[model samples]
Target: MRNHSGHDQADHEGHGGAQPGGLSVSEHGYTLEFDSTILTAGVQPVSFRVIGPDGQAVTEFLSEHDRELHFIAVRRDTAGFQHVHPVMDEKGTWSVELALEPGDWRFFTDIHPVGHDGTMTLGIDVAVAGPYDPRPLPEATGIAHIGEYTVALDGELLPGEPSELTLTVSRNGRPVADLQPYLAAYGHLVALRVGDLGYLHVHPEGEPGDGATAPGPGIAFMAVAPTAGTYRLYLDFQHNDVVRTAEFTVRTATAAPKHAERHHGHHAHH
Candidate 1:
């Protein structure tokens, strides 16, 4: 397997190999260029392009989970998270509308070039001009309520290991059995480390059309935390033909030490 940097996955064997997200606007010879870095506080249109290693706008990209590009915008205070798909023109420029608020906002573009070896998530921060009152991050919890729906998260996130997470959706104290498929799965999850909003990839356990995967009250996913830290989770699901997102804050468990292996290796050297 290959990492976002086009390097062998082995490089990240014991730790995170790829550069931390939201720290740079470019990586792996690819650049994320925005039309304007400053904007007013309100709904506006944003545009950007991905420059390939050849210094030209990358016009071709493979669709991931039925989307060419996944654009995520979140406030620096871990608030106002939005996940939307942008349409790319022939010139390789992608444009999308966003509801902007005052404060520093981070933009993350998740894409995979047609011939690229692996998926890359490039991010940049933009300034929104206005009175900014940053909100505090909600306490870590396993339950989240959005509108009339309540989502119960059951799972533990362990550092360096894939942890199984199951989210059960309900409404009016009853299980929701008519969950619709979104992004080829019963639910789509995106995890971001709290402090820097580092993008953490969360994989769905199965597909909606798969005979074994049911579209019902429970959605299963495998999430691997890069390190032991607080993470914000955004779960996107569809019901009644409308898409809604449920947010949760979770802290990852500490990684177990490999003490026995280290002790044996130390003795063998003597």
Candidate 2:
């Protein structure tokens, strides 16, 4: 079945199968191993590698959107989300610098190996040492204000159906008409379910200069809700050579009843 965004049920999980990513460090024959599971606060060095089925580090990978691996780090309480690309060494060890706060964090690695069947998104958790305090998730809202831009999310997430979600961008009450491309698209969207931080695949409806897609004012995305629950969405967009992220908390509606199926099965026992 499709979710409100018209995407397949599997899309809410990860690609290539029904299993979800970021739930475990090892999944579907590939393992996400890190040099250290414990890190310190501040801008620090973080390194990890992907172990293939042969029990060795995978050094070669097919680039996706100009990057071999896309690393996403977020605090456990739905805070501090960063989407970045780490540099891989000759030994397949990937390292990147992240400004981390004191708390538990989860890392998601999205990659595609040259010989692998499809893209793999692996998840692992790391601990940040020091005093820790968790932040409560923000209440559900359609509008997200960050920096000089204000983004208003318009759409409802319905379970087991395809839904169209549009995010409108404005600055100081004026519509933004020129949104620069970021990561090969006008915007990059990442969604995670609230409870488990389950990764959801949110697809952009169109790309920049795609003949019908406008660069500004509104960016459309399509996704399907796998279930009824609250989800956090982060949208990254570039404008005037700088990239910024807008986050939103959304809840999906319960799945619609299948009246037709019920009726079909009720054959009046004649």
Candidate 3:
């Protein structure tokens, strides 16, 4: 749909159909290939490459958000979220160390090849060998505490509609007004649907140098949920020259008739 950092994908070659990314391993003749799909649990090195239509590892890429590629790893149950950058060799093999647990994890790459008209996100699943115990999704909440900072979310996600979400940061009950720019913006937000792990990467409303934009207490974003369901949000922000992530679980707010609302309330109380 209307995803991808507030840009339309219709102009892209392989993005004719409007849909969220990270649901497939290959798209637009590009495939995400891993050296191995199975690994032992713990912090270890992982390697992978992007094979282009010509069946060669892609080496040239355009930078987006101040980086050539963005790597994301998360458990299938919407736990263990990590956003990190990996180093790519001349042969196009990307290497990074991840603290992986015993479970099924999804690895996503957001990249823009040199010749490609636009950026794309590709995903692959890997099995970490060991005892696997999946955890249930956490309950929805608006407040997230990371270290000594507190982040409060205000707004709702509406299905098939663009919703504005604002996150305010504070420390010890004082507003944080000196947030440094991370990835060319005040903050970066990543949203994944609970079931399919559909991905949406969004940036803030304005950039750091823009005169109208403030580095401050609230970062605003426009997000469109593909459907009515639960979602896990990860916000990466930088302050004091250090980056930190704040996590939150959110549910789409759907408008219902009065009687339906009453029924839902009654059912909840019963």
> Best by lDDT, which number?
3
lDDT of 3 by residue, 121-161 (tens): 99999999999999988889999999899999999877665
TM accuracy, model 1: 0.88
Candidate 2 lDDT over 72-123, as tens digits, reads 9999999999998899999999999999999999999987787876676789
Q: Tell me each candidate's RMSD, in Å, in order.
A: 4.2, 4.2, 6.6
Q: Candidate 3 lDDT (Cα, whole model)?
A: 0.85
- Where in model 3 is the C-alpha error above 4 Å? 1-18, 256-270
Better of 2 and 3 by lDDT: 3
Q: lDDT score, residue 127, model 2?
A: 96
lDDT of each: 0.80, 0.80, 0.85
Q: Look at candidate 2 and tell me the lDDT of residue 111.
A: 79
Q: Hey, what RMSD does candidate 3 come out at?
A: 6.6
- Prediction 2 TM-score vs. true: 0.88
Q: Pick the candidate with the highest TM-score.
A: 3
